[model samples]
Target: MLDIVKQWAWYDWVMLFIRLISCFSITATTIQMEDYLTLPLWVVVFWEIIVFSVPWICLMLSYRYYLIAEMLLFGGLSLYLTSMFPEAYLTLLTPAFLIAANSAEKSYRWSAPITIVFLPLLIVLFSREIDVFEIFPQIGLAYVLGFAFHLLIVNHRQNEIIRKQNSVLEQYLTQIERVTLLEERDRLSKDLHDTMGHSYVSIIMGLETLRPDVASQEGTEKLDSLLQLARKGMKEVRGYLHQMGSPQDTLPLVHSLRQLGEEFQTHAKVNVRFRAIGEEYPVGKQVKMTLFRCLQESLTNAVRHGQATDIVVSLYFEPQQTRLEVQDNGHGMENWKDGFGITTMKERAAHLQGRVSVYSERGEGTIITCFVPRLVESADEIIRLFIVDDHSFIRESLRTILEGQRDLRVVGMAEDGAQAVELCEELEPDLVLMDLEMPNMDGIAATKRIKEKWPGIRVLVLSTFQDTEKAKEIMRSGADGYLLKSIESRELAETIRLVHRGGTMIAQDLLHKMLDAQSANEQEELLDAPNISEKDENSYGLTKREREILQMLSQGMRYKTIASKLYLSDGTVRNYASALYDKLGVRNRDEALQKGKKEGLL
Candidate 1:
């Protein structure tokens, strides 16, 4: 009975209590004064018992049966009780009926409203027979209580449902996290085996060649080979570190193409050559990745579908645009309707604002060419910049150098982070060249505040020190780029222009030093903290692509440039940036970068 009551809604319980009270009140009235109702005492007792049981029966039954039963039982009882005993408290049954029907139905769509209207009409009809004040107020209060209880029960059930759904969602999310961790573990193990295994083998082979007492040419050659192997091993390890942190730090287009070529040669057993046709030029990361994907997808099709034995990937770096051609000596298809791979290839090309052309015939080899237009800031695109540094000479020097350019303007200057943030709000400049160390507030805090207010504002960090920790800190803070104080004026101007155009430029020397220092510290930490896994060390909950964007933004690249480089739309990039900021618990880029570095995400 208690379990059944527990299943009942609040209104059901209240209606049960009301029926019980009505039954007792009527019984007491009948016993104290048999003349009160002008009906037989036996009939009154039976009616009161019947009325008392109606709400309980209604609550226990299913919706369809409960509705029919409640109406018949309450309607018959109300007509009889009111007709026989006009002054009886049988009038209370009206509110109870309304509550029970609605509660049992799991909705108050019509029952409660109709009951309200019926009650007033009933009071009007029985105005002289019924005590106007007593019956009206009792019915009114009963209706109010019933409706309120019904509302409470509905809200309670909704809350319970929501809680249950939330629990299920949480469990799903937990499972997803576990899956992600497992995948990450698999990836890390593969990277470690591929990168470190080769280095260790080379080192071991070189060590085997060493002879303590030998002074022959063979021994000298062996020693030199050992030294070379050691150097190569160090380079490989550095490359691995870059992969863990920022791919753009070292994984350029040429490197990626070569890596892809090697992979094809190893797996497909095909002779592949990745050739560069022009002088090397800095292309956007988006263009590079797109070209890489184009090569990858085309090469895959050639090997799997086309059964190609040899392939040539040509990368053409033109003055205005970049072009990639994947030519394979494979079996050409007769009817070449775009399938999933071809469609995806076209989509990737289109995403870069590039066009893809597939030329294939039955006997002749297939050639896939993709041409992506490079985004270069035109002469008319002048970028407004603000400089914030404590040293008057540095600020003046930067302003003089930048303002001299036709496409650059120094809109404001500040000596501290506070001033920088305040001036940024007022000026709303396109870019801000900030110094990490300053009075009133530091660049880190200022960048965070400024970015929180104006997310679009790009911040470039200029510092004298090459401290990896500071660089990581500033990068984490959301600075788009970092530069050393020792930078040449011309180089500084070019870097500013590059960053303004949505390209990233970390002073190469600073990056190398930071990487080296970081690698060493990581080695030491690895030895000291052997239990720390890759995910545990750097799980700020960001994807590889997001970290890439964050790395670029830390180097002071703008959204448009990042989008172009990433081969994403401005809106997509903005959404990613916004999501990144949220995950890092920041409102702007600076804080995100700062938080990322602190959390080891950088």
Candidate 2:
């Protein structure tokens, strides 16, 4: 009813073989009547070879289904006809058995119509038999039964083979999905590590600028402790994602350009007080990317080859354009021959329609200036915001950023978390900018208070420390969000709104920390243990860039250091430390230094 005849399975082939053997065996049993079947013997021998031989030839020639049909046709015909001439040709039973064997298979469809037309011939053959119905009727029945047995074998084998193939295919597909998932996760890790690493360094540096505000002797000790803690965090961060490091965002344009004469003064250096002409605005993404790279190349050259400690970084930002000049009192490049670092720097400059000029001589300092336009657009009006930092400079700086936005208006500002807490009571603005380590009251204490008092108001954490768990704990205290101040200003601004709107924010390294999804102790013992934090990065004899890298890695820095230190974005500084790690024969910084001392690298 459902046309199952066309849906025949491979089991039919087994039926064909069984039928052939059975019919052939039937004729062998009639050997005693050989003389009685003498006439039929010649016909049986001649056609037996023709029927079996032709089908085999067709099979060998690749007519697989055609051969199946032929086998069915000849088997059926010989069985019917030879039964009438039983004594005449007993051997004909063998061919009849062959045809019946495969008759159930779909391949025998062609034989179906032919067998119908041959029914008349079948009647004629049966008519010659005396009492044919009574004698040997079970002979044909046995042939059919053997074919059924063959069909069962075929069905079983074919089903087993198909089931095995399906299993293999499913496994292959699952493997592909796992690979894709891993690749996506890696990509996200690189992004968070790169963008947030530089941001953390800058935040730490900015926090260092607030050391003067710490009033008490106990506070000073805490400040020093905090400073060490912060630097250690930075060092550890460099270890993991050292390759994906973004160009040092630590030097906010103004810091890199001027007022740094005394910071590195212990090292003996000249100063360049290059200041902006008017109100200096932050550069664009493309320009920021270029300036970062150019400065990196200059810094690398200064630290590595510039013997003269008198180095000056001058940056002048005007409304229309921004100019960066890095001057040093050291031997400069003698020839135009460039290495990969310098070439890379040049390529980045070209991307922004900018140019870089270098003037250098032996025993003389070098001056590298990269000039690019400071294209300004009116700030977007995204959301209203407020900031509370113990450091006046930080509060003022963040306030300026929020105030600059046409849409965002700072309702109020506070110097300490205490004042912020009080302000939250009165102002009750949309969001609260809670600095983690604040004077009088810390962000954690203030957040606990605010959440208890005004749970609706969101607290966005701004901190330099790598103790992200501290942030997590603060979030547990009802703080709505957390962010390291070193993050891109735009990202910071965006994260605030997202958090205020009920979204959680995390530092880039948080993902790396969570990558294993195991406890800290378990992570250390994991198979193929992924390098996590940088240990003893400060004690390591790494130069500034390398030290910066170690700090990032130790703090769970991902492979975005290339983007941080070198200013390459997207796929920039990935895999930079893999070979370095191998050469050091150490898995991480602590081991690298221990080994380095053995090799006199210390």
Candidate 3:
């Protein structure tokens, strides 16, 4: 009841009043004059109800701007009816015209007063027995007062309806604002997971990968300091998980650079140092963090590609902006291919509305600098994660594990191979745990296909199939590994470590497969699947994507089903099949299938 009233609009009240008045007056009119079938109440009732009800209904519909037609219609109807009804039935016109004209309460004020003054003249004209001036004026004045009072009450009711509508609008606006905030939080969290969260993880990983003894004593202290910073980052992530908003602070840029210098010195055989050139002040936390990431990414590049003996870190701060530089003395940039670390560094710099520079000489060194603009960083980011598995328990379990990792969060869950593939592609998980034998794209097939497209990705096939055939098939298909799905919690960590180690894991089973193969070599290996050449594509005059479609069509997947698999529209899929059929000199799915099979296109 409250919800309905809350949704009711200003016009609804006037319409309701008009309806009530109309209902009463019409019923009274029916009693007064026995004209039921001939009377034109349909137009009046429909107009009144719609004019009142539609406005309220519009209020209920979000994103619907106000429509002006209802008002114009009601006003036009009132004017027409007023002109015609005055001559035919004055009593009915009095109420009907008043209710219809009641659309504009403001107009009633002026029109009602004028009509009051003119009423005496009207009565004199209409009545024969009534006195021309004295009695008519008295009756007109009484009618005017009563009509004005009714109009005033109706106008007041309109205002109350408006007030109530405003109250509801306020609540709705608040809900919308909250939803917006949550959505914003979700967006920021995704940014962090892919950006800042990954940043910190790399920082910690770099720090841990470093050996303390490999660096100088001073460098050791600096590396220790970096570890402490990582711990501080963990705390911040924890505070967010606890829903506690904290004052975000940036560690000194010098501290982060020094830490990186020592870490690089230990991790790689590089002599690295931090040097400050200009005057420094407390730059904003966001700026400092951006600078830190800049240094970390630069160092990662240097270690990964440049076999350097020394690297220099410099900072120059001014009123408008700050400059961060990491120069490496390494094999240099001439032959250095594109790396993720460099891309991330450049991307992060751009995200900060800043510019990054990379200058390198073949023999001298690679120099990287970033200029950061001023932007206040959001303190809280809500992470969203999605996990896919055949079991709900596995999804929940993975969620628990991921959530346990500081700064790692999960947003959604999915069950089964198909859903897993869907969510993996949709969420683009940092890691995908593939389970072997489930409906819709078996683990082996999904892993191979996903890796073929995205090679740098990490996928660990968690399967109960301990068979060497499974292992051989999986790895050959470019899967990261085939692990016993029921790996103990203790063993899981090591397996993950192997996975993220940037290579496939060769367990005892895999080793046995390798050794057995070495002992009894088979020429036609189970691992090697026949690859279709461009010669085959040209022979068939169909692309691999087209061939795959033709094969599915041969297997009898409807256009809709094909569209779902290929992530294309049904029309697009039909067009592809149509083209394929045309190419094969055949019409329809079956002929295409038979031709495809004959040509080995399938």
Better of 2 and 3 by TM-score: 2
Query: 447-543 in candidate 3: lDDT tens per residue?
Result: 7676656555567677644567776777666665556643433345444443453334444334545646743543243124257655554455464
Off by over 4 Å in 3: 1-135, 212-225, 240-559, 562-602
Error of 2 at 489 (Å): 1.9
Task: Tell me the whole-model lDDT of each prediction, alpha carbons only.
Answer: 0.66, 0.55, 0.55
TM-score of predicted structure 3: 0.28
lDDT of 1 by residue, 1-602 (tens): 66557557565666566667766776786667777556788887886676557555655655555555555555455555565467544454554445533554444555554455564456446534776666656666666776666667778877865654454345434534643454454345345644474356556555655656568988879777877777787678656644554343246677777776776566555679888888777665445656766777777777666767689999888887788899988789775645556655654554444567778897688999988766554687888899999877668878987787777889999999888877887898988998988989998899878766875777778876656777777666666678766554555666666566544446544665665776687667556865444763454445455677888998899987886575343544665675466446577887887786776665
Name the best candidate (by TM-score). 1
Residue 122 Cα positional deviation in candidate 2, in Å, after optimal superposition = 18
Ranking by TM-score: 1, 2, 3
Reference-based TM-score, model 2: 0.32
What's the CA RMSD for each of the models? 24.0, 28.1, 27.0
Candidate 1 vs 3: which has more TM-score = 1
Cand. 2 Cα-lDDT: 0.55
Instruction: Tell me the spans in candidate 1 whose CA falls farther than 4 Å from its real position.
Output: 1-320, 324-375, 485-602
How well is each residue in 1-602 modelled by candidate 2, as lDDT tens digits?
13333434555445446446754554464344557553577565556555655664454344445445464656454554456554433333343344444454474565433333343245436656534453244345544554565566667866755654454334334433643454445444455554665556567777787788988899889878887887787677656544433333334666543433333332222232344455667654345546755765565466456644456666677665688888887667665344556645654554344456667777677888887744333355345566888767677778887666565668888888788878787787878888888778888888888866875677778876556567557866766556666565675665565555444455544533532343454434532433322432323323233434544555555654333344322121222343235334467656755565465443
Residue 147 in candidate 1, Cα distance off native in Å: 96
